[model samples]
Target chain A: MFKRGTLVVVAFVLAVLLTACGGAPAAPAAPAATDAPVAAEPFKVAVVMPSTETDLAWSQAMIDALRSIQAEMGGEAAMQISISENMFNVTDAAAALRDYASAGNQLVIAHGTQYGTSMFEVARDFPEVSFAWGTATDTGEAEGFTNVFSYNASAEEGGYVNGVIAAMLSTSNVVGIVGPVEAGDAKAYIDGFEQGVLSVKPDSTVNKTYTGSFGDTAAAAEAASTHIAAGADVLTGSAQQVVGAIGVAKERGALWLGTQSSQASLAPDIVVATQLYDWTGVLKDIIAKIQAGTLGGTAYDLTLENGGLKIVFNSAFPGVTPEMQAAVDTAIQGISSGVITVLP
Target chain B: MEQLFTLTTLTGILHSTIRLATPYLFASLGETISQRSGVLNLGVEGQMLMGAFAAFFVVVTTGSLLGGVVAAIFVGALLGLLMALVSVSFRAEQGISGIGMYLLGLGLSSLLFRLTLGSVQSVRGFAELALPGLSSIPVLGPALFKHSLLVYVAFALVPMVAYLLNRTTWGLNIRAVGDNPQAADTLGVPVIAIRYATVTVGGAMAAMGGASLSISAVNIFQENMTGGIGFIAVALVYFGGWRPVGVMLGILLFSLVSALQIWLQLVGIGIPSDLAVMLPYILTIIALALAPRRTGQPAALTRPFNRGMA
Candidate 1:
């Protein structure tokens, strides 16, 4: 209770509170002419996702990419990451996005299309803060915001490849596409798949159904069943709830191709290939740009040539033939060279 | 588009109907029991979620599908006890309490899944068990006799629930307490005890519906996986006029129209995809408008009974 003891105690309490608040790490003083000192601040990225990180679809894809990036770039101490997941409600998501920027995060990724308005609004308030979002190609340039970056994938390139293989393997000459909604990447993938099937066999009919929701497993399963009953020998879909469709396919002994993330583990034998959305390189580039003072204004498109739109063949699939592999490779090359335009 | 009524297509539609109706059947049947006892447990969705998570976790940890189902039932019963405590014993506002229960179930299930499972993973779900001899009988066999054990349980509960709510002495007391609790109290029927029993049964059955979804239908568990289907089940309770047979009819109509809508889209039938997607909901609303005013609803539904006040 002495006066000197009280001064030390108060100073200790304030330091603990500040650290607990996660205030920006105090920049170490310019070493005072010390040797072997690193001057870089930790690169922190905060993400607000619409679904759980374990969704194995859109949200999971980003999370997996972040974790891999974290490990590759010298782990958590060097690169800090925080996530607010299951933000399906826009109001909560907006609050979280604002909170992250205010907390002094170096980069914030609002990982959903529905978040565009909130993200832009929040981005406007913090011009110096870096923000990213999408399944979109716009960087908010028309709005004159340089701190917002967009990323979209050419999922059709992989979907087209899947359709080619599906048609070749199908005896019924029918492929089914189960989609969550008929917009954005879902539409692009399905459209590409239809054309890919027709490219191999002009008579091949690709039936597509949109379940109206990304998380409706029951609906997805029902759609898969209807497609199978209608004589589809192969099926493919993108989104989180395609797990249900894949389950039905595995049961009926039908082949399945997946996208958004690898679904091979869900059904090893039946899953032929997955359009792996490898955003790792893109994410790394974004981080590097943020580190280099280019907060935003650049949008990244994942295409075949960039090593982002990869067709990951499941080793467990027995349906693959040497001829089918050759055809898929040719389609990839044609797509990369711009010789083939996938039209649905 | 023109030749829509082939035997093969009809059978396929019928099969789809049965598959889609399982969750609805379980949920509505469970809700019916609670309403029959004068407790409007609008927490069926929450109960279903708790059940789904419990079932999923148990199955993953122990590798026992049966254990997963029972765990769901156990969780449901515990939650029902919570509901009974809040509404029956405490006599809180039934509507608000029911909603609170719903939110609690929703939040806890999601939190638990993230904590325990860490990520979405799949377990070996219940396989379809085609009944011997019966599964071979032309179109009907493949459509009706080929389903998982959970499907049979859901369908079987219809008759069992009918008999329980109508025939037994306990059923008589439930109806009595639900209609006029003061009168039942005068007649020496334990009103509070019967309410707890009925709510617990309702919760367990609802949880079973959720388990059926994860373990049998979808074969994987995801957050918000029930996707408001529990709310639909509650609607079915009113649509079915609170009768087991009537509820069954409502479920069949819902699943049939749902399947037919998807089929229409596939066949390139001229209906706009947006309108077609809304077929089941539109049909449900239409049926409700055309139906009777009071479809055997209990006289004291959602009313908490206090002995001293009465």
Candidate 2:
């Protein structure tokens, strides 16, 4: 009897495991066939992301933009979207890209920089399908690809603006940065932030540390603690991993400036402001170009001047005084009008 | 470099080191018990992820930290039980099954998170409980005494586990099963039962280690948030030479080095941040190499037992 019970338990657990594995990778059931003569054969778009759609960081920004576009174009019926999220492995991501392309996704979006090599390979095979990937400006033109689109966010512009706000509100002349890695957009944001802080308070100290990972929340939290211990009153960082740092900042009552996405929802009280990425304008442009037969070759950038990167201040935190707000607005205008160069 | 020597900086490093090491301590110590019973569970990372999600989910919905911790422990044990059924009862390859478990835990937790809560949310997890008198000591007080309840529980488990593994009759039976299962079986020891218990306990502890992160350390959960900490915990068991105190020391050394590297970057002493970040990992390899070669590996580890076969 005991042996029989054990077998039953094992079978049940295995069934649950199989179901869980089966549930993922099955892209949310394609918006149930609309009976009312679908609006213009739903523009099929597929996206392969490095992390989950709700990471509230890099991946979330793109997903939110796509959702807004879908809403604008009339719902799921007018704009069909398929997402294969958490594709951290390049090989697996390559396979996912191929699968989407073969399945007739007209415009396939590989939403991570690491997917460049695989994307170009897949784009080569499906010349008719338009491919887009970003936080990069490589259109793969030199590499001989035409159906590929590249978009980048001039993150430093908003990073500099956030830095200006941090400098104005910081009581202790010391600021801290919990960086992920010293490369890509993360690097650009940090460099620009340091410059903004120094531009305002030349004597203020900004201690920066990269935890060598984009997902090591524990390490990020420790870095935040280290910063707080060193007398830093204002903190800021980019990437999805900043959630951990934000938690630490909230506990220590340190003001935080965010980048890449709006982290105001994570900790409204302590997250004073966030430099959010609004990719809607860029996505629409890419869609239009693709529809107009301009499959590739042009690289686009999301900048403050183009109204793609926005600085959103949290109302829950009263730290941004009218003067501080004015300083931020001035910095934004300067960057947008080309009067202020964010990076050297 | 001199800035790192200040009392505040030193104490700060020490404080963060304890907080950082708590998860490793729980997971590795639990791994020690499992390996001591001759079952090597490589699915610890998966167990931790499930535990983290469970704890975070419960806390967000119920607003009770205790409820979160309990849910984590329960979910962890259930996964552990599944591992036992696959390895101990079915006699499948332990390593392969463990990996399968890990993938299952990862996918299930992520799917559940999406299906239920849908977005990233934070909850107030464990609050630091400063000891009555010891918390007042200068430098060390704030550094060591003030931490979430889980940190204290994790450290306390080390000695209890040590005593359980060294002094108790049950510990002897576990050691016998790991070292010579056939002999243990002939002598009337319930090998399968002991293996199940140890593996299940290991899963529970690994999960708690994960809970420590979501409910205590960061108080937030993201997919794969453990971020290979579970694998590191498994390595610390080998580094500690399969002993509880040794595992505790290993965890301290690794976490202290990690803490030091973070400090090095904070002080900006001119070393590149990339090189600074590699310090803990590089130091761990060096320490593992330099340590005395005392192979205390369980002979029966990874060997599924059968009554009549050798």
Chain A, model 2: TM = 0.88
Candidate 1 lDDT, tens digit per residue, B1-310? 7535877677788888998899889889989999998999888889999998899899889999989989999999999999999999999888888889889999999889888887666677788899999999998998898889999999999999999999999899999999999999999999999999999989998998999988888777888888888888988999999899999999999999998988888877777767788899999999988897794999999899999676
lDDT of 2 by residue, A1-344 (tens): 99999999999999999998987665454454455444346788999998878777898899999999999989888888999988889899999999999877879999988899899999999998899998789988987889988989888888899899989888899999999988888889999999999999999999999999876777788889899989999999878788889988887789999987788888999998888889898889988887666788878888888899999999888777899889999999999888998992
Interface RMSD of each: 1.5, 1.0
Report the Cα lDDT for residue B274, model 2: 91
lDDT string for model 2 (B74-175, tens) is: 999999999999999999999899899999989998889889988877888898899989999999998999998999999999999999999999999999
Tens-place lDDT digits, model 1, residues A187-277: 8998898888999999987888888887887788889999998889899987887988888888788999888888888789899988888
User: What clash pairs does model 2 have?
Assistant: none
The residue pairs found clashing in candidate 1 are none
Candidate 2: list runs displaced more than 4 Å: A1-39
Worst 10 residues of 1 chain B by lDDT: B1-10
